[model samples]
Target: MSDSTAAWVAAGVRSVIGAHTQAQDAGRTDDVVALYTPDAVLELPGMDPIEGHDALREAFKSWAPTQPQLHLVTNTVVTPGAEGEATATSDVAFLQRGESGWAVHLVGHYEDTLRRHEGGWRLHRRSTTFQ
Candidate 1:
Protein backbone atom coordinates (compact mmCIF):
# COMPACT_ATOMS: atom_id res chain seq x y z
CA MET A 1 0.00 0.00 0.00
CA SER A 2 1.09 3.55 -0.65
CA ASP A 3 1.67 6.01 2.18
CA SER A 4 -1.67 7.73 1.54
CA THR A 5 -3.45 4.40 1.53
CA ALA A 6 -1.78 3.44 4.75
CA ALA A 7 -2.77 6.76 6.29
CA TRP A 8 -6.40 6.33 5.30
CA VAL A 9 -6.48 2.86 6.78
CA ALA A 10 -5.00 4.11 10.03
CA ALA A 11 -7.54 6.93 10.22
CA GLY A 12 -10.37 4.57 9.43
CA VAL A 13 -9.30 2.19 12.15
CA ARG A 14 -9.20 4.93 14.80
CA SER A 15 -12.51 6.35 13.60
CA VAL A 16 -14.12 2.96 13.97
CA ILE A 17 -12.70 2.57 17.44
CA GLY A 18 -14.15 5.92 18.50
CA ALA A 19 -17.50 5.45 16.79
CA HIS A 20 -18.10 1.91 18.00
CA THR A 21 -17.32 2.83 21.58
CA GLN A 22 -19.74 5.72 21.41
CA ALA A 23 -22.41 3.51 19.94
CA GLN A 24 -21.83 0.79 22.48
CA ASP A 25 -22.55 3.17 25.35
CA ALA A 26 -25.63 4.40 23.53
CA GLY A 27 -27.17 0.94 23.92
CA ARG A 28 -26.36 -0.61 20.58
CA THR A 29 -24.38 -3.74 21.31
CA ASP A 30 -24.08 -4.47 17.64
CA ASP A 31 -21.11 -6.49 16.42
CA VAL A 32 -17.82 -4.70 16.79
CA VAL A 33 -15.86 -7.58 15.35
CA ALA A 34 -16.72 -6.60 11.83
CA LEU A 35 -14.36 -3.67 12.14
CA TYR A 36 -11.40 -5.99 12.39
CA THR A 37 -9.96 -8.76 10.32
CA PRO A 38 -10.56 -12.36 11.28
CA ASP A 39 -7.15 -12.98 12.81
CA ALA A 40 -6.48 -9.71 14.54
CA VAL A 41 -4.79 -9.63 17.92
CA LEU A 42 -4.37 -6.93 20.55
CA GLU A 43 -2.08 -6.82 23.55
CA LEU A 44 -2.33 -4.31 26.35
CA PRO A 45 -0.10 -3.95 29.36
CA GLY A 46 -1.10 -6.07 32.36
CA MET A 47 -3.74 -7.82 30.30
CA ASP A 48 -3.70 -11.01 28.27
CA PRO A 49 -3.39 -10.58 24.56
CA ILE A 50 -6.69 -10.92 22.68
CA GLU A 51 -6.67 -13.04 19.56
CA GLY A 52 -9.17 -13.09 16.71
CA HIS A 53 -11.85 -10.58 15.88
CA ASP A 54 -14.34 -12.20 18.25
CA ALA A 55 -11.94 -11.87 21.14
CA LEU A 56 -11.26 -8.30 20.23
CA ARG A 57 -14.99 -7.59 20.24
CA GLU A 58 -15.27 -9.26 23.61
CA ALA A 59 -12.49 -7.08 24.91
CA PHE A 60 -14.38 -4.03 23.71
CA LYS A 61 -17.52 -5.37 25.32
CA SER A 62 -15.78 -5.33 28.67
CA TRP A 63 -14.95 -1.68 28.16
CA ALA A 64 -18.34 -0.55 26.85
CA PRO A 65 -19.66 1.41 29.79
CA THR A 66 -16.49 3.27 30.61
CA GLN A 67 -15.89 4.20 27.00
CA PRO A 68 -18.44 6.94 27.05
CA GLN A 69 -16.84 8.85 29.88
CA LEU A 70 -13.24 7.96 29.20
CA HIS A 71 -10.97 10.22 27.24
CA LEU A 72 -9.04 8.40 24.49
CA VAL A 73 -6.10 10.03 22.78
CA THR A 74 -4.08 8.64 19.87
CA ASN A 75 -1.23 9.87 17.70
CA THR A 76 -0.40 7.55 14.83
CA VAL A 77 1.92 6.98 11.90
CA VAL A 78 1.37 4.40 9.15
CA THR A 79 4.43 3.41 7.13
CA PRO A 80 4.55 1.06 4.19
CA GLY A 81 5.89 -2.37 4.98
CA ALA A 82 7.51 -4.87 2.64
CA GLU A 83 5.24 -7.10 0.54
CA GLY A 84 2.50 -4.50 0.12
CA GLU A 85 1.74 -4.22 3.81
CA ALA A 86 1.98 -1.38 6.30
CA THR A 87 2.62 -0.80 9.99
CA ALA A 88 1.01 1.65 12.37
CA THR A 89 2.53 2.97 15.56
CA SER A 90 0.38 5.09 17.82
CA ASP A 91 0.93 6.85 21.09
CA VAL A 92 -2.15 6.30 23.21
CA ALA A 93 -3.53 7.79 26.38
CA PHE A 94 -6.53 6.52 28.26
CA LEU A 95 -8.16 7.57 31.52
CA GLN A 96 -10.12 4.97 33.42
CA ARG A 97 -12.79 5.87 35.93
CA GLY A 98 -12.08 5.71 39.62
CA GLU A 99 -14.06 6.20 42.80
CA SER A 100 -12.49 9.55 43.59
CA GLY A 101 -12.48 10.38 39.88
CA TRP A 102 -10.58 9.07 36.89
CA ALA A 103 -7.29 7.84 38.32
CA VAL A 104 -6.02 4.89 36.26
CA HIS A 105 -4.78 7.05 33.50
CA LEU A 106 -2.02 5.74 31.24
CA VAL A 107 0.27 6.84 28.45
CA GLY A 108 1.54 4.20 26.05
CA HIS A 109 2.96 3.39 22.64
CA TYR A 110 1.08 0.99 20.39
CA GLU A 111 2.87 -1.14 17.82
CA ASP A 112 0.48 -2.47 15.23
CA THR A 113 1.05 -4.86 12.33
CA LEU A 114 -1.00 -4.17 9.26
CA ARG A 115 -1.44 -5.96 5.95
CA ARG A 116 -3.11 -5.00 2.74
CA HIS A 117 -6.04 -7.23 2.09
CA GLU A 118 -8.59 -7.31 -0.71
CA GLY A 119 -10.74 -4.86 1.24
CA GLY A 120 -7.91 -2.67 2.47
CA TRP A 121 -5.29 -2.42 5.16
CA ARG A 122 -6.27 -4.32 8.27
CA LEU A 123 -4.58 -4.81 11.59
CA HIS A 124 -2.99 -8.18 12.23
CA ARG A 125 -1.38 -7.58 15.60
CA ARG A 126 -1.18 -4.77 18.13
CA SER A 127 0.84 -4.50 21.27
CA THR A 128 1.10 -1.59 23.67
CA THR A 129 3.63 -0.58 26.28
CA PHE A 130 3.20 1.85 29.13
CA GLN A 131 5.29 4.98 29.30
Candidate 2:
Protein backbone atom coordinates (compact mmCIF):
# COMPACT_ATOMS: atom_id res chain seq x y z
CA MET A 1 0.00 0.00 0.00
CA SER A 2 1.02 3.56 -0.64
CA ASP A 3 1.62 5.90 2.26
CA SER A 4 -1.79 7.49 1.85
CA THR A 5 -3.54 4.14 1.60
CA ALA A 6 -1.79 2.86 4.74
CA ALA A 7 -2.80 5.96 6.63
CA TRP A 8 -6.38 5.55 5.49
CA VAL A 9 -6.51 1.96 6.61
CA ALA A 10 -5.10 2.85 10.02
CA ALA A 11 -7.65 5.61 10.39
CA GLY A 12 -10.51 3.30 9.49
CA VAL A 13 -9.38 0.69 12.01
CA ARG A 14 -9.01 3.33 14.70
CA SER A 15 -12.52 4.56 13.98
CA VAL A 16 -13.93 1.11 14.54
CA ILE A 17 -12.12 0.80 17.86
CA GLY A 18 -13.30 4.24 18.92
CA ALA A 19 -16.87 3.46 17.99
CA HIS A 20 -16.77 0.23 19.95
CA THR A 21 -15.70 1.99 23.15
CA GLN A 22 -18.28 4.73 22.64
CA ALA A 23 -21.09 2.26 22.10
CA GLN A 24 -20.14 0.21 25.13
CA ASP A 25 -19.95 3.25 27.36
CA ALA A 26 -23.37 4.34 26.16
CA GLY A 27 -24.86 0.88 26.80
CA ARG A 28 -25.66 0.48 23.13
CA THR A 29 -25.31 -3.26 22.84
CA ASP A 30 -26.41 -3.45 19.26
CA ASP A 31 -24.00 -0.77 18.16
CA VAL A 32 -21.15 -2.42 20.00
CA VAL A 33 -21.82 -5.75 18.38
CA ALA A 34 -22.10 -4.12 14.99
CA LEU A 35 -18.48 -3.02 15.25
CA TYR A 36 -17.39 -6.65 15.24
CA THR A 37 -17.69 -9.32 12.60
CA PRO A 38 -20.45 -11.91 12.87
CA ASP A 39 -17.93 -14.48 14.06
CA ALA A 40 -15.81 -12.19 16.14
CA VAL A 41 -14.17 -13.29 19.36
CA LEU A 42 -13.75 -11.12 22.43
CA GLU A 43 -11.49 -12.16 25.26
CA LEU A 44 -11.80 -10.12 28.40
CA PRO A 45 -9.57 -10.46 31.43
CA GLY A 46 -10.42 -13.48 33.60
CA MET A 47 -13.22 -14.61 31.29
CA ASP A 48 -13.59 -17.14 28.53
CA PRO A 49 -13.62 -15.77 25.05
CA ILE A 50 -17.02 -14.59 23.91
CA GLU A 51 -17.59 -15.61 20.33
CA GLY A 52 -20.10 -14.65 17.65
CA HIS A 53 -22.51 -11.76 17.37
CA ASP A 54 -25.25 -13.46 19.35
CA ALA A 55 -23.00 -14.16 22.30
CA LEU A 56 -21.54 -10.70 22.10
CA ARG A 57 -24.97 -9.11 22.29
CA GLU A 58 -25.89 -11.15 25.31
CA ALA A 59 -22.59 -10.38 27.04
CA PHE A 60 -22.92 -6.66 26.45
CA LYS A 61 -26.49 -6.65 27.62
CA SER A 62 -25.62 -8.37 30.86
CA TRP A 63 -22.95 -5.80 31.67
CA ALA A 64 -24.81 -2.74 30.43
CA PRO A 65 -23.74 0.16 32.57
CA THR A 66 -26.21 1.70 34.97
CA GLN A 67 -24.05 4.64 35.93
CA PRO A 68 -22.27 7.05 33.63
CA GLN A 69 -19.22 5.42 32.15
CA LEU A 70 -16.43 6.51 29.89
CA HIS A 71 -13.57 4.77 28.14
CA LEU A 72 -10.37 6.72 27.58
CA VAL A 73 -8.47 5.02 24.82
CA THR A 74 -4.94 6.14 24.05
CA ASN A 75 -1.60 5.17 22.55
CA THR A 76 -3.26 3.26 19.76
CA VAL A 77 -0.87 1.63 17.29
CA VAL A 78 -2.09 0.00 14.11
CA THR A 79 -0.28 -2.42 11.83
CA PRO A 80 -1.54 -2.99 8.31
CA GLY A 81 -1.58 -6.53 7.09
CA ALA A 82 -2.22 -8.11 3.71
CA GLU A 83 -5.00 -6.45 1.73
CA GLY A 84 -7.95 -6.39 4.11
CA GLU A 85 -6.44 -7.33 7.47
CA ALA A 86 -4.88 -5.24 10.20
CA THR A 87 -4.05 -5.28 13.91
CA ALA A 88 -4.05 -2.69 16.67
CA THR A 89 -3.04 -2.20 20.27
CA SER A 90 -4.42 0.47 22.56
CA ASP A 91 -4.34 1.42 26.22
CA VAL A 92 -7.68 1.97 27.91
CA ALA A 93 -8.77 3.67 31.08
CA PHE A 94 -12.31 2.77 32.06
CA LEU A 95 -14.03 5.22 34.34
CA GLN A 96 -17.41 5.18 36.04
CA ARG A 97 -19.35 7.71 38.06
CA GLY A 98 -20.71 6.68 41.43
CA GLU A 99 -21.81 8.46 44.60
CA SER A 100 -18.22 9.49 45.19
CA GLY A 101 -17.83 10.84 41.66
CA TRP A 102 -15.97 9.42 38.73
CA ALA A 103 -13.23 6.90 39.39
CA VAL A 104 -11.10 4.72 37.24
CA HIS A 105 -12.49 1.20 37.32
CA LEU A 106 -10.02 -0.57 35.11
CA VAL A 107 -6.78 -0.01 33.30
CA GLY A 108 -6.11 -2.31 30.41
CA HIS A 109 -4.68 -2.77 26.97
CA TYR A 110 -6.51 -4.23 24.02
CA GLU A 111 -5.00 -6.22 21.20
CA ASP A 112 -7.28 -6.44 18.23
CA THR A 113 -7.31 -7.99 14.83
CA LEU A 114 -9.50 -6.27 12.28
CA ARG A 115 -10.61 -6.94 8.77
CA ARG A 116 -12.02 -4.61 6.16
CA HIS A 117 -15.66 -5.19 5.42
CA GLU A 118 -18.23 -3.73 3.07
CA GLY A 119 -19.34 -1.30 5.75
CA GLY A 120 -15.81 -0.48 6.89
CA TRP A 121 -13.35 -2.15 9.28
CA ARG A 122 -14.71 -4.63 11.80
CA LEU A 123 -12.96 -6.32 14.69
CA HIS A 124 -12.31 -9.97 14.03
CA ARG A 125 -10.82 -10.70 17.45
CA ARG A 126 -10.03 -8.66 20.53
CA SER A 127 -8.11 -9.68 23.59
CA THR A 128 -8.01 -7.39 26.59
CA THR A 129 -5.49 -7.62 29.42
CA PHE A 130 -5.97 -5.59 32.54
CA GLN A 131 -3.11 -3.84 34.27
Error of 2 at 62 (Å): 0.8
Name the top TM-score candidate: 2
Q: Would you estimate the TM-scores of all the predictions?
A: 0.67, 0.97
lDDT of 2 at 91: 98
Local accuracy of candidate 1 as per-residue lDDT tens digits, 1-131: 66676667667666655554455445344455554568888888888889987677767777666433543546767666676456767776666566667754777787877666566556678787998
For model 2, the run of ten residues with the poorest summed lDDT: 115-124
**Would you list the C-alpha lDDT of every candidate in the order shown?**
0.65, 0.94
Candidate 2, 31-72: lDDT as tens digits: 999999998999998899999999999999998999999999
Candidate 1 error regions (>4 Å): 1-31, 96-104
Clashing pairs in 1: none
